[model samples]
Target chain A: MNPCNHHSVSIKEMQKLCVSLVPIFNHLQPTEMEKIVHATRSASYQRGEQIYGAGDTSAQLFIVHRGLVKIFRLSESGREQLIRLLEPGDFMGELALFSGSPFDHFAVAMEQTELCVMTREDLNAFIEQHPKISLRIMEEFSRRLERAEKLISCLTSEATEQRIAAYLVELADEHAANSFTLPMSKKDIASYLGTTPETVSRKLAEFQENGWIEQSGQRNITLLDRYALQNL
Target chain B: MNPCNHHSVSIKEMQKLCVSLVPIFNHLQPTEMEKIVHATRSASYQRGEQIYGAGDTSAQLFIVHRGLVKIFRLSESGREQLIRLLEPGDFMGELALFSGSPFDHFAVAMEQTELCVMTREDLNAFIEQHPKISLRIMEEFSRRLERAEKLISCLTSEATEQRIAAYLVELADEHAANSFTLPMSKKDIASYLGTTPETVSRKLAEFQENGWIEQSGQRNITLLDRYALQNL
Candidate 1:
């Protein structure tokens, strides 16, 4: 699939869409946001497209204007471990820019995704000129570190059932409703929770049998017992 | 232990000692560094002292000038999962400063440790005044995030023996020598690698039997064949 063919977005359109979408630039004046937009190039990725994979040396920041991205790393045996998901307003590739190191993970678009990209030199210069951006970047990093640490705790401490239950509850909370669509595939969920697809499916079924959740097909899940899931 | 009693050093002496210790402040001019020192309080922790733990509301940054610190999270069943260790020139508690979230893990002094402490508000004000500090903070965050991601990959994808092999290789690389003392305990290493103490002990012995390593007690290990471990 041609990622660009899916959405032929203009530079001005992307600038207006992404300037306010990016957390760092949202606080700035329109003129200042325009200055940052000038440094970026608009791009799109089709669903399941390999946006960038391991060993990519490009130090360009990919800011999600729309759609989803899954960042993951693979084992020597070709087993995947999902790192984290990036939604609209989230960005990736900052680490490579700072460390001058090749990316050790892969990023894939989960849906038709729109992005604004800026090169390392340009983004570094932008942060230098507007120091507030650096503060925002630090805050973003702190948030990500906290999340990564939480995942470590989950992978090490929590059981498979609890992991799935917690994820469902989290999604319900995010939606502020009992019913919500799954954000990622079961395989991806299994990878995210450090389990296999069969284990994920088994635990999910057990949750359903216990009346903690209701499922219509694989994606639509409604939480019937939030308290139980939370306790789990 | 009284954090201050172990270090009765004068404020001037502490300022001089710590001005060159913290990574963020080391590059600043001596006068500028002294300005930051004035904003910090000098404190010390005895061996095994609990510096901070989960749910602690204090939002003060702790910068280690000497000795060691360990960061970990506890499972619901009271099992400890070591996150990472902190040593000289390392700092903690910045997450609270940025997110206003209580710490979700525990931090302890592994030895009698001297530190410089700065409250979140003070550090925020300092960063505002010295914007380059924000850049440095971003760089530090990038480094830590990269580490956290690597750990996630290790815990999810690698087997226990492989994990042990990788850790040994890492420690060797850090020391730039074939022989080095283990910076942490086997139990702690197990927690860090998401395994058990018995498994860690077994793996080390296996590596020894394979002629890949030589060991005297648990603390000292010499890599006889770095290539074998690297290939492991």
Candidate 2:
């Protein structure tokens, strides 16, 4: 599939659609929405392309328009700590936009990805005019904080297999099916779970051997015994 | 010190002061501020008393008017992972206030603590009338997310000693003095750093042996060689 294929939709219309889809901008006044639509620019990155990096001062508000983006930070010990994964309709770059600080982490395109971009100045002006947008932004931040805190607990306390099990259950629920494709590679999953890629592979193999799950391909996973995995 | 001794100041006056001092309510119009002031309530918790618990549905915005509060989560493994220590003027409970969801963690008073709180409904009303407050809330969320991400990196990748050193340096900077009392107990610090209390004690002893720090008592710490700690 050609990632760039947008059919008959014009780029301008697509940009407006992307902005409208973002939770922060939803239900805005027609004119208020127009201000955002006018300011947003559509951009795309190829798989493996770096979108932003640590210490980048000019961070703009980016709404993931399509595909996947990886957010990670390089630790002092020279290991990458996966911070978050942004899927379509998710937004990032708020830290810099809100605090006027440089990026503390990095963002890369995990696959062919499109983003609806807005300069900090433009977004700030829009936010200033719309309290609803500000409220939405707070809600997004609150949700992310809750998830981050959970991840902290998982990283500090849960064993490798338990964490992996928890992750699979979460994914199965997200996909609403027993069989689903992994959203990320094993290496990325390991970084996110605070384990090594080898450990993730070993744990998955063990799970398969115990009839807890089945792996058809590198990314396709089937939860054969989700109850067992959940209870693990 | 008598935690309840507020001289002759009335509770209403104190509540108004607390709300005004919060960054989110700062710079509000007189009438707008009056709405929040009318809705704000003052409450206190004794040392070791829980302010809220995980799964609590009636979460209200809590501003630490005085004393320390500990925010932590009990993981599936039954280990306590300290998420943050809230000092005076810090606020929490946004998870419920913004999204109307239950809290995923618990908060307890480390000392006799005073709080300025507003119910989610009342706070929502005030926020609807004040765009400035919403923007400030978004900014606060952004700041906390950045810190949370940093903590995730520290917990997952940093050595216990390095994390401890970073915490000490942070406290020194916060206090603006090389000699200051520890804000929280060693056990709490250990939990925050994902280590055991014994390890924390051993590491502090090692730091003193290396002339990097001096602990006069259980809580008083003098950063004799802060530069060394920074370079650790």
Candidate 3:
């Protein structure tokens, strides 16, 4: 499905949307934000479209304006190892902004997606002129490093059920609501947690039966007791 | 063993040493480096000393000048989830430099260690005055994030032996030599690779018997055939 065909937005509206969701630019003065908005271009991707791939020369920063994007690497055996899932207000392809290196993973649209992209050259120049913007970017990177470290810890020590529970808790916090929808399918969640779809299904069902969480549908989950879920 | 007692250096020498190892400082002009040198203080820790713990207020950035430091977190069952081991020229506690938050893991000396410490306020001020240094630090953080993501991929899709092979390849590349000493013990390697020491021991034996590598000691291995190991 071509999202742009169905829901078109003007260039000015696109710029405003881009400026509003990008955390680094949102805190800036109106003039500063306008400068960035002018530099950004909006693009759309169909579900399963590749935004970028491993070994590709990276020269743009992509901010999700709508829908979901999956960033992952393919293992030697052809299995997908999920690195991160970019939701609205989340950005990707940041390593290129500083390192000027080829991307080490592939980014694909998990659903029909719209994104605002700014060229690396432009962004770097702006950062040079505005050092505080660079500092804000650093804070974002620090948060990502912390999340990556936590995922590593989960993979190493936590059991499958515990990993799922922790992941749900993380999602709840990210969404700022105990009752929310899962962004990805159970199969994707299984891959993200380094397990199988069968296992993820079984675990979610077990949680439902145990009264720790209530599931209204396949994607809708409400945390009945966060403390108990955490203890798992 | 008291490394500082046995081999002492003056404050001037210590400051110069600290300035030399930190990548950001090394890139700055000598005068700028000197400013940082004056702000940093020298410290030492014995083997098995806890440098910091989870929930500890993080106020200083630590640059390892000598010996090894292990960053890890403990599960409720007391199982340790190893994060990363810091060697000479590598720094830690950087999240505090930007976020002003507590550390989420424990940092401990794996051996008699010497370090240079800079308070968060001083470092932030230095970064503000020298913006290029902030870019350099961003590059370092980017490299770390790349490594952590690769580790996550290894944990998910690689078998135990494959993971060991991949880690050895990484170590070889880092040292710029096919033959080098492993910085950590077998138990530590097991923890880092998400496996057991027994499994690590068995895998090394299989590799040795297959003529893929030569093990001189528990901590020294020569990669006899890089082509063969890469295919594993």
| Best-fitting candidate, scored by TM-score | 1
lDDT of 3 by residue, A1-232 (tens): 1223312556568666675356766556666766666667777998899988888876678889888999999998898888888888888887876688888899999898888777877776676667666677777878889888988888888888999999889888988999989888888888888888999999999998999899996799999989888998
True contacts kept of each: 0.69, 0.72, 0.56
Residue pairs in collision within model 2: none
Please give the lDDT score for candidate 2: 0.80
lDDT of 1 by residue, A37-119 (tens): 67777777888899888998877888898889999998888998899999888889888877778889999998988887878
Q: Where does model 1 exceed 4 Å of error?
A: A1-14, A20-22, B1-14, B20-22
Q: Assess the local accuracy of residue A78 in candidate 3 as a C-alpha lDDT between 0 and 100.
A: 91
TM-score of chain B of each: 0.92, 0.86, 0.87
> Which residue pairs overlap in candidate 1's backbone?
none
- Candidate 2 lDDT tens digits, B1-232: 1124343455458555575356667776655555666667667789989988888876578888888899999986678888898987788998888777888889999898888777877766776676666767777888888888888888777777898999899899989999999877888788887789999999999999999998996899999998898778
lDDT of 2 by residue, A1-232 (tens): 1124343555558645575356667766665556766667667799988888898876578889888999999986679989989988788888887788999889999888888777877776776677566667777888899898888777776777899999999999999999999988898888888888999999999999999999997999999998898777
Candidate 2 is graded, for docking, as medium
Q: Compared with the true structure, what per-residue lDDT tens digits does model 3 show for residues B1-232?
A: 1224322556568665675366666566766756776667777898899888888876778889888999999988798889998988788887876687888899999898888777877776776677666677777878889888988888877887899998888889989998999988888788888888899999988988999889996789899888888888
lDDT of 3 at A195: 88
- lDDT by residue (B80-164, candidate 1, tens digit) is 9888888888888878867778888998999988877878677766766676666666777889999999988887777778889
